[model samples]
Target chain A: MATWLEGLIALVLIIGGVFLLIGSIGLVRLPDLYTRLHGPTKATTLGMAGLLLASSVVSSITQGSISVHEWLITLFLLITAPVSANMIAKTAMHHDLTPWKRTKGQELVDPASRQAPPSDHHSVKDGKLP
Target chain B: MLTWAVIIVAILICIALFLNLWRLVQGPSLQDRILALDTMYINSIALIILYGIHMGTGLYFEAALLIAMLGFVSTSALCKYLLRGDLIE
Candidate 1:
């Protein structure tokens, strides 16, 4: 019975590994900044979750008790992945980084044009666009 | 039977790693590279857990946690740099 359980845990780990690899590939192969961002943010999060789940399961089985640390890491990964992606995208916008244009799409509007109105946007509200 | 299953999973993970490596090397922009790095961080965590299983030691779990923490910090720093033009002002 114990051996059976170990096998199952190992299977989960393998599957999780596969997901991780796929996420990495997307990070490498996607074109354009925004498009590439989608790959790692979405796929990699799932991948990590799978691996963590497998680890937690195995640890629980081996130690005869629940393993919560792996779960915590998984939780952290899920929450941070998207948030980090957002931060990067927003920063790209702030720094005037250009997004890739695939098909002559409106000549790629200036990043400044997408700025929100300067009312509650800035914290100080010192008559400056924040 | 269980051993067979574990072996199969290991194979799959190896394939996935190859795919991710391709992305890491082929990324055309700096942001993509950063994304790849983030993915790599997650992968490493998973890899560490698997290594723990293989070695039958719980210590690798601690290493995985550390990797997770470092990954988050590094990615945050990179994102900040990407946004503000400097990691520290």
Candidate 2:
């Protein structure tokens, strides 16, 4: 007889694997960099979180002691994924990489605030704070 | 049943890892390759965790944590290098 604990762990693991697959598919299928950025950052992050949770469940059930350490991995990933995605996107924009026509890429660049776009930052810099 | 699920999930993640590998090798831009590498490491962590589960031990957690740290730092450095043409100013 399959235990409920085993069934739950299996379900979570399968779901996590599916999401990882979807994220990779998105990476390959998406045409533009900005759109492509969404693949690894969002879907893959969640997928990893799912897998970590499943691991925690399995460990706690079998060893009769909760493994709280795995949660640290999940927490670290959740915090970093979005930040890394943001930094990578900013770098892409600095390179003047074009976005898809359907994408309103300019909205990502706030005109009213922040320093000049990375491309112009060099030439526009007077070594003065404005 | 749990073992079967682990096998299936591992296979799926392996397929995903290969896809990320393809992108890393056939990248049209540096950013794509970096992103692919980042995703690849993340998938590997999943694989490691699955291995730990299969072994019925949490010992692999340390290795996964190290991979996570190294992957993030590398991705950030690569992206920074791309943006500024230097890793550190």
Candidate 3:
């Protein structure tokens, strides 16, 4: 039973590793910043979750006690990855970085207004308007 | 049997590392580099866990945790710098 359990855990780890590998590859191959972020945020989260599951299984089997460390890391990664990506995208917009647009063939759009600039967009009182 | 599995996972992690390395090498913009670094951070954490399994030591878990913590801080700092050209206002 222990051996079988180990095999199962190993399978999970391998699958997770493959997902990570694919995500990294997507990061490289994707054309634009927005498109690239899609790969790592989605794929790496799934990959990390799988690896953590494997770790939890191994820890439980070997030590005969449940290990919660991997679970915590997985939870943290899931919560943080999307927030970080969103922040980066927003920052890029705030700073006027170029975004890859599919229809326009890489035309540079104003970072603050990827569409139209708001007349009241910049407000000192609200502190919420950028 | 477990040993073999661990070795396989380690090899796969190495491949992932190489993929991220490629991004680091050829990324066109600063943000791309930051993204690559973030991905690399997570890859290292996974690698450390596999190493822990191989050596039968739990010490590496602490290292993994540290890397995860540092990774978030570093990425945030980079993002902040990219935004305002300063880490602190």
Give the Cα lDDT of each candidate: 0.68, 0.87, 0.80
Instruction: Give residue A28's lDDT in candidate 3 (0 to 100).
Output: 86
Top-scoring candidate (lDDT): 2
Highest DockQ against the true fold, candidate? 2
Q: Model 2: C-alpha RMSD to truth?
A: 4.0
Model 2 TM-score (B-chain only): 0.97
Superposed by TM-score, candidate 2 places the C-alpha of residue B2 at a distance from the truth, in angstroms, of 0.5
Candidate 3: tens digits of C-alpha lDDT, residues A1-130 = 3767778887888889889888988998888777888878899889889988887777766787877878878888888898889777766566566666572423334525344444355553344445
Off by over 4 Å in 3: A103-130
* lDDT tens per residue, model 1, A2-111: 77766676666666656666666666565567677776778768867776777677668778889788787888788888888877666555656666666233233342
- Model 2 fnat value: 0.88
Listed per model, the TM-scores of chain A against the true chain A are 0.75, 0.81, 0.77
Instruction: Assess the local accuracy of residue B89 in candidate 1 as a C-alpha lDDT between 0 and 100.
Output: 90
Native-referenced Cα lDDT, model 1: 0.68
